[model samples]
Target: MTIEQVWAQYRQSLKAFLHTKVASPNDVDDLLQDVLLKTHLAIENLHKPTSVKAWLFQIAHNTVIDYYRKNGIHSNAQQEITWYNEAERNIKKELAQCIKPFIQQLPEQSAYLLEVIELEGKSQKQLADEMGLSYSTLKSQVQKARKELHGVFNACCQYDIDKHGNLIEYHQQATKGKCSPNHMDCTPGVRKKSDDKYAHCSKG
Candidate 1:
C-alpha cells in the first residue's frame, strides 16, 4: 500500500491492533512509531495490495513481540488500562519474562557483551576494538556466549515450534530455579529502562 493509503486507511487500524497487545497507552504510542518505521521500510516489498490489511496486522503483532523481547513482562511494563482486556496471558510475555535473569545467569562480562551487541546496537567488530580484542576472537566469544545462554534457557523451558519452524508457544518446565520463567522481576530493554543502567538484551 502507498503511504497515502496507509495514512488514509491503515494507520488507525494498526494502532487499534497494537492496543490489544500493549497494556499501556504510552507504550502503545511508542510502539506505533516503531510499527510505522518498520512498515515504511518494508512496505515497498509487499506485492499484493489486497493483502495489505493482513500484512499490517502482522507487522503490529511482530512489533508487540519485539517489544516484549526488548522489555520483559515485569511490573514496570505492566499497567492497568481498563479498556484493554487481558488477552490470554500473552504468550510473548510468558516467554520473555525470564530473559533478564537468564542473561544474568551468564558471566558478568557475558551479560555486558550481549547487552552491548544485542541491545545497544553495537557491531561485534566495534565491540572487539573497544574491548581491545581480536575480531575473530570476539566473534567466537559472541557465538559461544549465545550458545551458553541458549543451553541455559533450553534446560528450563520447552518451546512449541510450528511446522514452519516458527515459535508458536512455549512452556516453563523448570520448578524452583534461577532460570525459571516466573522467578524474576526485571525492567529489561534499552528504551524506557535505559536510565536504570546496563540496558537489556535483544535485537530484531
Candidate 2:
C-alpha cells in the first residue's frame, strides 16, 4: 500500500494508541508522524511487513521507547509504561477476529480439529491417547488441520513467502478487508507467539 493510503487508514488509530503511552498531545502528534516517516522509510528495509497495522504500531512503540531514552528517563520509570502489554493484546484480538471467519469456512473436520487444538487449547498427546493414536499421529493430524486452515486463508488473500517458507507479505482480497493478519508465529496452536509478526502462516 502507498504511504498516503496507510496514513489515511491508520493515522488516528496510531495517535490514540500513542496517547495511551505518551501524555502530551504535541508529543503524541510528533511520535505519530515519526511513526509514519519511519514506516515509509523502513518498509523496504524491514523483512517484508505483512500486517501494516501491527508494523505501524510497533514503530510507534519503539518511538515511545526512543522518546523516553532521549529524555534521559530512568530505566525503572520507562519500565512502568504499559503500551507494549496493550499492544500485544490488540494484536491477539486482531488474530481472533481474522482467523475464525476463515476457520469456519473450512471442512467440518478440519474446522473442529483446529478449534480444539488452536483455539480450545487441547493437548494433542492426550487427545491422541483418547483416540488410541500415537503422539506423532496426533501431531500429524493437527498439522493437517492447520494446513487446511491455511488453505482457507489463502483462498481469501494472496500471500508471498520467502525462501525459507516464511510469510513475507500479503495483499488482501478487496472483499475480504475484515481479514487481519493471523500473527500465528508460524505455529497455529494455542501456543503463545513471540514478537515475530511477519512469520505467521509460513509454509514451514
Candidate 3:
C-alpha cells in the first residue's frame, strides 16, 4: 500500500480489530499506532497484492501479542488511563490536595527528577548527565522518588472507591520470568521481562 493507500485501506479496520482485543480507548489508540507502523514497513515488501488484508491482519495480531508480552496487560499501560479517568470522575478535590502538597514536600532534586523522568519522559541516563550525577546515583534517586510518589498516590486512594464503596485493587502484576508461545528457555535473551533492570537487580 502507498502512504495514502495505507491510511485509507487500514485505518478503520485496524482500529476495529484492536478495539476487540483491548480494554479501553487508550489501548486502542496505542495499538493503532503499532499497526500503522507495521503496515507502512510491510507495504514496501508487498509480494502478493491479493493477501494485503491477511498480511495487515497478521501484523495486527502480532502487535497485540507483543503488547501483552512486554507490558503484559497488567502494567501502567492499562490502568494508566483508567486511573486518570477514575480520578477525574470521583475525586478531583482530593487529587489536587494530595498532588499539590506532595510536590511541595519533595526535595528540589526529587521534584526535578519526577518532572523530568515521569512527566517529561527523560531516561535516567539522560537526566543523570544533565544534572552532573552518576547514572547509578540518578537511578537510585528515581527509585526513591517513585516510591515516594507511590506513597502519595496510595494515600489518595482513600477517596478512590467503586460503586460498592470498596477500595479498588490497582497493583501491577510484575511480568514473570517465563516466556511463552515459542521461546521458553533458561538462556539470557529468551526470558520474559529480560530487560536491563533485571540484570542490574541480579548483580546487586
Candidate 2: the clashing residue pairs are none
lDDT of 3 by residue, 61-170 (tens): 65665456433243333333221222122122222222334444467777778766644445676677788998788778877985775454333221222543222222
Question: Over the stretch 69-129, how does candidate 1's per-residue lDDT look in tens digits?
Answer: 4443433224432233343223223333335556667887887877676545466767888
The alpha-carbon lDDT assigned to residue 141 of candidate 1 equals 85
Task: Per model, state how many residue pairs clash.
Answer: 0, 0, 0
Best-to-worst order by lDDT is 2, 1, 3
- The per-prediction CA RMSD against the true structure, in angstroms, equals 17.0, 15.8, 20.8
Candidate with more favorable, higher lDDT: 2 or 3 = 2
What candidate 1 gets wrong by more than 4 Å, as runs, is 1-98, 166-169, 176-182, 185-204
Model 3's alpha-carbon lDDT is 0.47
Question: What TM-score quantifies how close candidate 3 is to the native fold?
Answer: 0.36
lDDT of 2 by residue, 113-161 (tens): 7676555545666567787988787778777886776675555455453
Model 1 worst lDDT window (10 residues): 185-194
Candidate 1, number of clashes: 0
